[model samples]
Target chain A: MTINAEDLHKVAHLARLSIEPEATERYTQALSSILSLVDEMQAVPTDGVQPMAHPMDATQRLRIDEVTETNQRETLQRLAPATEKGLYLVPRVVE
Target chain B: MQWEAVIGLEVHVQLATQSKIFSGSSIAFGAEPNTQANVIDLGMPGVLPVLNEKAVEMAIKFGLAVHAEIPERSVFERKNYFYPDLPKGYQTSQMAEPIVGLGYLDIPLEDGGIKRVRIHHAHLEEDAGKSLHEDFHGMTGVDLNRAGTPLLEIVSEPDMNSAREAVAYLKAIHAIVTYLGISDGNMAEGSLRCDANVSVRPKGQEKLGTRCEIKNVNSFRFVEKAINHEIQRQIELIEDGGRVIQQTRLYDPDLDETRAMRSKEEANDYRYFPCPDLLPVELDEAYIQHLKETLPELPEQKRQRFTEQLGLSAYDAGVLSSSRALAEYFDRVVELSGDAKLAANWVTGELSAQLNREGIEIEQAPVAPEQLAGLLKRLQDDTINGKAAKQVFAALWAGEGHTADEIIEAKGLKQVTDTGAIEAVIDEVLAANPAQVEQYRAAEPEKRGKMVGFFVGQVMKASKGTANPQAVNQLLAKKLEG
Candidate 1:
């Protein structure tokens, strides 16, 4: 559960975030604090306590397996920033 | 030396929610890069995370589908990471208290055996934005469109033995998710993805070997290939007296090999902690019971019913029940055709084959269930022969929505059931082919089949399949014998 400031800095760089150099120490402290809180769960003695995955015991509320949504080109296109003739245009994908 | 490959899958399915898991952003696909991204999705300051009730419902639906336990209280944990696509620099997911747990899915094996894959847990989480590396050159561009999309991380126990079981398990998860209307489960759209924790030990070994996690395997074929490649690599290392390192790896599908992404033993990138921004979501027992009541017949139950009630073969039942769309389609066909076995046959056989060939789905099929039933009824009633029905089926599949009777009537495809018309044609054929008839009488009796066949063809040409095949054969035989 121990994390180093240098490790935090490295992971930040690898993830391509523009983390300020001064923020690394702060992040290192905050992450350790959170992990320590997670560590507190070990003391709860989950020997017989079951791990939970969902909030309900219901199994598979399935649909009739049909496509309900279809042919909404105009509605979907409204969200696009740049579109021409039903094609989304980004900043020149190919040079 | 018998070596068993023990495999397990950790599949991540994006839940079908109207909004982002922790935000109100629209959960729409193929939208512009940042249009759907909201303040919470963008990880903007002071934007508190709000759990989408629909996402929770979907997780409950999935839990119920697998017969898993749903916890009354679950906490969202911040998986601390720095990824450009992860706008918050930490993913909000269930870590300690997941939503579902201790489930098992019974998968029917190819060899008439059954394997029960123990479900570890399925937790709800938010999706990260996409990295558009392919679109951008040199540097990867981030699209926050998918950020905050709800996802359910379904982890399975290491009970799988081979690549086949793993694929089956993945497919089962896919069907469950799609059936529950949880997510489209489209891997190509990144709605469904799999990360595998693969390891190798000698066959029947008690100790689990050093494991490596393979990330973001999108396709089922890739999951099998990546696991096989990784398994071979691990086995080779163990054989050579080398230790398999615990780390995260990436499957280079182009090279068909797995390369190390990071050393997990050294640094687990995820430093998980309960998120203070979101409180524990507690569901009451009554609500949970109501959800249970609403769950439809699961894939296994439907498959069993198709086999027992519909009298379909296990294979056909499995195919039909594989997806909600397919099963419903089959049911509609049966309702229309009023023949369960025949409906199962046409839906699984001809309809499925056509859909696969066109890379479409049952929902997208041009031929409606009523149209298919109508066509089959035509064949049943001798209004059109089987050969002519195929042509009608093809035309109907190509957007021609004419009824079977109408198509047969329009194309003059009716089977010739009239004996008088067929007899006239048979007489003309016998008169025109006296040489062949004489030769047939003079030659061996076997040669008579050829003469009769010629007469039958002439009758068919004259009557244009309107002549009943039984009638044609009977009339030809009587004349030839005389």
Candidate 2:
């Protein structure tokens, strides 16, 4: 994978970051260097090599399917930026 | 014009570990925002993530459940990105070397159809924080509470042909995850979320078309809508001689449309190198053997047992064994109820319906399995009629702790099983309806039924529905013959 100037801008935009104009070229070069290293792993020939997905060997942790939380509204509401009455308030969007 | 829709799902299941995958923070829900977050999750300087052993165990459990291969070693790579919700400005996840590989989920489609969607792989990843846009007028507030949550991103091969197939695949995966107890698989609480990778091919084509990934579809209904809408969009692009652009699109459930986030015409150079902070996770045979020993009876095996041993219908078994919790509930009810078929009926029919209607869960059900079994036994033994049984069931649902016998005694709900009492009532009805009796005895044999019904109703009224219908009908018929 190669990172061009346009690709850097798109990556930044998709990530919702405002990359400074000067930083875009710097990131493109850095990202390209990183991708080259990753591309090397592809050539290792994974023929008959199985991909690893998880580390643990355990399967199927059984839960009784019960509600474990309740009546902690006061505790949870403390994390909100703004609260009106019992509801969390945000900027209204639609009329 | 005939058209075929191709669909596949990318499910991110939050592993039900006691702590975050990388941090020591508790994975408890409904905690104060930022309270469950630790320095590692915040991605602060000088903080390093230590992988949770339980997460790896869960991933292996899932792999084993799906009959996938669990690699002896796997590596983690950094997914480079910058967002307010992403504390580290990068996500450490499995990319090239995922832990589980080459599993497939068998899905039952509509109309007795079956489709097996190949699973590409399931990788362990940490969840990012929630971005709450409502807090500010134009700014999105970031809550790191959900950040660092451990998730298993299960990606499926693009093999589905319709929305029904896609939903069925989602459901099947959901069942597997929940049954494994790796995830609660609750869409509303964000424990389980889906991203769909979809594309369309011409009626007959060897190669696949350009694919666009739809992001964070929160519900099963939304998955269906998002896939259908994306399919239409792709088909339109092809029909108009335009190409479908490969990009990440966000599904706006409120608008029922998918909007392009960005074009990924070229692949991302994530610069994904192995994390230097974390070593290659190596599992020894002894550890793997221990995890294997801890494995429970999986959903498929339980469903088979339900069918063969319990004599439950496939549909009934599927519904009961869909989640481990539901299966346990069925077992408990059977233990108490004594009749497997009746227990299956109550758990599937009444209990499930009530749970859905009341928006409660089986664990929170007011009627315990023992209580339900007791009520059913009363009905079976003719201790109470059906109507009284229903009344007792309502009392049970209301959390009345009275036993079935107590409820029956308190409400005078016992069936009038005394034949002598019922026979006396039948005689009185026969004397009162003499004309109808004569008509029944004369030329109209069919009119005899009406007379018998009249006598039975009188017996019921005299006994206040405590009289068993079978006993009443038998005594009335014998009196009519006389």
Candidate 3:
């Protein structure tokens, strides 16, 4: 589960984060320590126990299906880095 | 030397819920960009997602319709990816335990046989928003109105061996969702879409070949063509001594070919983990039972009823029961006319023809079911012959009259069943064509049967197509013989 520098750069790229070259080694070590902690949990044996998704074992609270949203495009689009024709604009995405 | 294509479909059905799956934002289509997006949909800080109960109900209905296992507990996980359309850096989806468990759908094939496509599972997820590339001056425009829309992604086992079976399976899913009232199942509106995983292996090989997925095929025809194109591409690649690479491909419907979008090596590893913001969905026995009881008669059950109880052919039953609206229309017609076969014929034949011609759906038909049944009733009672019934139908379709009797009466198209009146028309037709009559009398008996149709036509023409054809045939036979 430990991430090396090369894999960390790839992960950072996938996350669309640009990490400085000096910070790559620091990130790799920090992420690998987190993985080591998760690895410690993996070593514990609880074969029959179900995997826990939430700490409190609470069921999902349901909401009735209703349209409570109002038009806020003008307000939201203003927060974007760029916008045109009421849409949030970004660099061209081909696929 | 023969290659067989193995196809599996992953269909994303937008649940017909009013709001987004986890947010209270509207899921209505055709909204202005980002108008329907609320704070939660926009991935603002401190916003939490609460699952929509209606969406869960819809997923349960689909699971039950396909005879799938509905687990009491399902967890929502974060599928992490980076796309501008996904304002949330990750999508909320079911990864480990989906709401719907294993199930199988028995799709009726074109050759009157059924093929059972095993379901791998179905998971509930929120949809990503749209990215408008056109008219953006080389930049991309993002619309978040579709973001966080509820979706039920149904995945199938690789059981379909041909394009035809894949299309049938897709169609069956379409019909089921539409019948369940869970989704509109409109491909044009993208309420229903499919991604096909295709591979080719040598015939009788136990191991499957490398699979490539064709993404976001919107229509059933395109699904078929895309799969065929992908299969051919794989087969050709293998035949040329090149191994097929696993990749995600896009089907260019305009080009009718599939091109690689990205290789599998570059595919995103959606680091999935349970979302701590949303709790696990736990269903009680009572809730599941209530959903089961409220379920409507599914397509297969209705098709069976039409065939066994109503004495309809399998094909006719399939056609009539394909959609709930159509089946209801047929049922109303049958109830009014008390003739299942006639109702089946008219519903599938003339009504369908006219609807196709006018480019309208059955729900938008100009003629109502009762009016059509009224026309069929006249034909049954000899108030109007078939030809006159057709004329009445045309008039009804044109909105000339509201009732079949009104149209028939206005056009004077009632069948001439009176013995005396028909006898006069027959006599006049015989006298008007004496030379033909003499020729008929002098002809052989076998020839007389053929010649009798000419007289019947002449008599019908004289009667303005209102004469009962069977009665005209019998009377014409006796008179021409004498």
When superposed on Cα atoms, how far off is each prediction in RMSD?
7.1, 6.6, 1.8
- Show what share of the native A-B interface contacts model 2 retains: 0.01
| Model 3 global lDDT (CA atoms, 0 to 1) | 0.91
Best by DockQ: 3
Among incorrect, acceptable, medium and high, the docking class of model 2 is incorrect
lDDT string, candidate 3, B107-179, tens digits: 8887778899999999999999999889688899999889999999999999999999999999899999999
Classify candidate 3 by CAPRI docking class.
high
Model 2 segments more than 4 A misplaced = A1-95, B108-115, B135-138, B201-210, B232-243, B262-267, B428-462, B477-482
| Per-model DockQ against the true two-chain complex | 0.07, 0.09, 0.81
Best model number under lDDT: 3
Question: What's the best-to-worst order under DockQ?
Answer: 3, 2, 1
Q: State the displacement of the C-alpha of residue B45, model 2, in Å, after optimal TM-score superposition.
A: 3.6
Residue B325 lDDT, candidate 1, scale 0-100: 87
Error of 1 at B219 (Å): 1.9
